[model samples]
Target: PLAIQQTISVYLIAYAAMSIVHGPLSDAIGRRSVILGGMLVFTLASVGCALATDLPTLLAFRAVQGLSAGAGQIVGRAAIRDLFHGDDAQRLMSQVAMIFGIAPAIAPLVGGWILGWAEWPVIFWFLTAFSGLLLLATWSWFPETHPPDRRVPLAMRSLVRDYVAIFLNPRFQRLAAASSFNFAGMFLYIASAPVLVMQHLHLGERDFGWLFIPTIGGMVVGAYLSGRAAGRMSGDALTRIGFVVGGIGALIHVAYAALADPFAIPWAVLPLFLTGVGVALIFPILTLAILDMYPRQRGSASSLQAFTSLVVAALVSGAMSPWLSHSTLYLALGSASLTLLGWAFWRWERNVCQRLPACPQETTAVEPADPL
Candidate 1:
């Protein structure tokens, strides 16, 4: 169990560290090159993971895989911001999120099927094939959304300056915190899946679908609703609705955890559905808002936001999951706390925006001051 948790944490740590670089690199070169390069590296790492014979070797390869895996998500976000704006961007983001939500539900089922027939290495082989396919698809279809004219030079000093500027901005901090904590509230459950499924629910490895399917299903529905609500509702209004739904889910989860006698399947997992809906609804809004803050440096903005979330995820997986997995009530309380933190951050951002002479949401880009 410790080894399993470590494996997950190491990947997330490497992923979080590299995320800071992936965004700026994409901003310097082009989204296409960075994504293609990362995919190629990820494919090779998957091969290494398959061949690894020992835990250390597997950890090494997993770290390598993590290093490369973040390029696509971070750079892809920048690409979306580059091509679209306003409601169009929100709709597309929600649509992409809806599709992406399916992966978590599908991966465990696929892995279980593979393990039933073959050994653990075959799973890595499957990942290799999947990443290889993605690489090919990207090479064939992905475009260079960031033109040379808009590209920032790859200078260490300037990169540091830009990072510092984005990180220190009050609005960026609030929005990133909101997004990260919101996701973390649910990710706590995901990271704790083994304990929740096997130990608490008394289910086997194959029964993971009971937990993931409904959660991701709710995410899909929420994403669909967010897409539908794009132009009709304001971002603030949408975000508020998302928080309300998520808060209710957290409270209900806490109530059930405290009251339930056995902690069974359908009932234990139902609140996660609401949490998923809330997360999906708020994610695209906060993401687009951050990207809009730095129009010319969307990649950088995306990277920082991803890094924030990944850091929180790593901590949750490594530390929180281990501590909280022992009790359903503990996990429920942790989730609720995270949700409250996210809502507080969102409220802070709103208050700050109200006080500003120009709303950050309306501003397309705030150009960085020259470090020199």
Candidate 2:
């Protein structure tokens, strides 16, 4: 179990480290090229994983997979901001999120089904085929959203400086922290899935859907509602509501963990549904807000945001999950704590915006400024 957890953690660590580069690289070159290159690398890494003969070899390949896997998500976000604005951007983001939410729910089931007929290597082979198709699709259809005229010059000094400036911005700190913590709240459960499902829930590998389906169902529903609420509602209002829903879910989970005698199905997992909804609701609004902060440096901003989230996710997976997975109550407390911290950061950002005239409003887009 520890080895399995370590394997997952190493991938996330590599992913978080490389996340910082993918965005700035896309900013320097073009979104399409970066994405295609990353997908190609990911496909090759999957092949390596499929063929790896030893644990060390498999871990190395998994790290490579992680290194390349983040390009699409990080760069794709910048591309979205490049092409769209305001409500249109929000709607598109939500739609994309709704589609993306399906993967987590379906992935385990697919892997289990594949395992029924073939060995574990086949899973990596399947990933290779999947990423290969994505590479072809991207090559055939994806356009260069960031034109050459708007591209940032590739310089290590400039990259470090931009990252420092973005990372240091008070608004960026709060927004990125808020989004990262919120996601980590739910990710705590996901990271502990082996123990939570197999040991605590006393279920088999095929029963992962019991946890994932409810969690992702809430996310999909929330994403759809977020898209619908795009033009009609204020981003602040939506964000506040999302936090409230997530808070309630966390509280409910804690209460259930405390009260439930033996921890049954459906009842135990249902709260995650609300938490997922909350995550989806606030994600698009916060992401767009971060991207809007540095119009010329959206790629950098997106990269930093993704890095922050991925780092937090890595910690939760590698540290917190292992510590808390032994006790249902402890896991509930950890999640609740993370959600509360996220809400506090969001509230702090709101207060700062209200008090400062220069601070950008959450509902409106900010004018482009120097990357610094």
Candidate 3:
């Protein structure tokens, strides 16, 4: 168990750190090339992982795999921002999230089945083939989103300057905080899943789906609704609604943990469903807001955004979760606390937006544009 935890956290740590590099590199070069190169690296690393006979070898390949994992997600976010604005962007983000949501719901089931027929190395082999196929598809079809005219030069001086500029911006920090901490609220539960299922709910390893399936289902629903709401609701309004819904879910979970002795299924996991809905609702809007902050530096901006969230998740998984996993109430309180932190950041961003002269004054919902 400890080895598994260590290996998982290490992958995430490597991923978080490398996100900072991949985003800027994509900005300096082009999205398609960076993505293609990353995919190639990932595919090869997956093969290495499959062939590894020792733990250290496996871990090294895992780290290599993590290094390439951020490329697609970061570049894809940049592409959406590059192609569209406002509601068009929101709808596209929601749609993408909805499609992507299927993987988490199905992955554990697939893994369990794989273990039934073969050893764990087969999992890596499956990943290798999947990534290889994706590489080919991307190579063939993925157009260059970042044009030559818009490309930033890759230089150490400029890299430091850009990173510093992003970090120093109070508004950027506030917005990023809102997105990252909100995710942390749900991630606390995810990080503590072993305790949640085994100790609290008295379930076996395969029962992860009990918690994940409904949660992911809710996310898909929320993403669909968010896509539909694009032209009808202002981003601020949608964000506020999401926070309120998430707060309610967090409170419900906390209250149940306070009262219920042995947490019951369906009921115990229900709050997670609501929280997932809130997550999908707010994610696209917050993500786009951060990217929009530095339109010219969208890749860099996406990098910072991914780095912040990944780092926060890593800490929560490695530090906060172990401490809080002792009891259901503690876990619930931890999640609630994170949610409140996110809400506070949102409030601060709202105030900052009101005052900043250059801040977009999006009083009305944006009208939908033709899907490109």
Q: Which candidate has the top score in TM-score?
A: 1
Query: Tens-digit lDDT track for model 3 on 1-372?
Result: 776766686688789989999888888789999999999999999999999988898889899998998898888899988888778999999877665544545566567668778988999999999999999999899999899988877777677777877877777788889989998888888778778888889987778877777678778888988999998878888888888988999999999999997788988889988888888888888888877777777888889888998888888988999999998999999999998999899899887775322376332221112222
**Would you list the rank order by TM-score, best first?**
1, 2, 3
lDDT of 1: 0.87
Q: In model 2, which runs have C-alpha deviations exceeding 4 angstroms?
A: 99-105, 354-372
Candidate 1 similarity to native, TM-score: 0.94
lDDT of 3: 0.83
Residue 315, model 2: lDDT of: 83
Per-residue lDDT for 153-261 in model 1, tens only?
7677888878887888888889899999988998899888889999999998888888888788879988999999988988888899999999999999999999999
TM-score of 2: 0.94
Model 3, residue 275: distance off in Å is: 0.4
Q: Every model's Cα RMSD, please?
A: 2.4, 3.1, 5.4
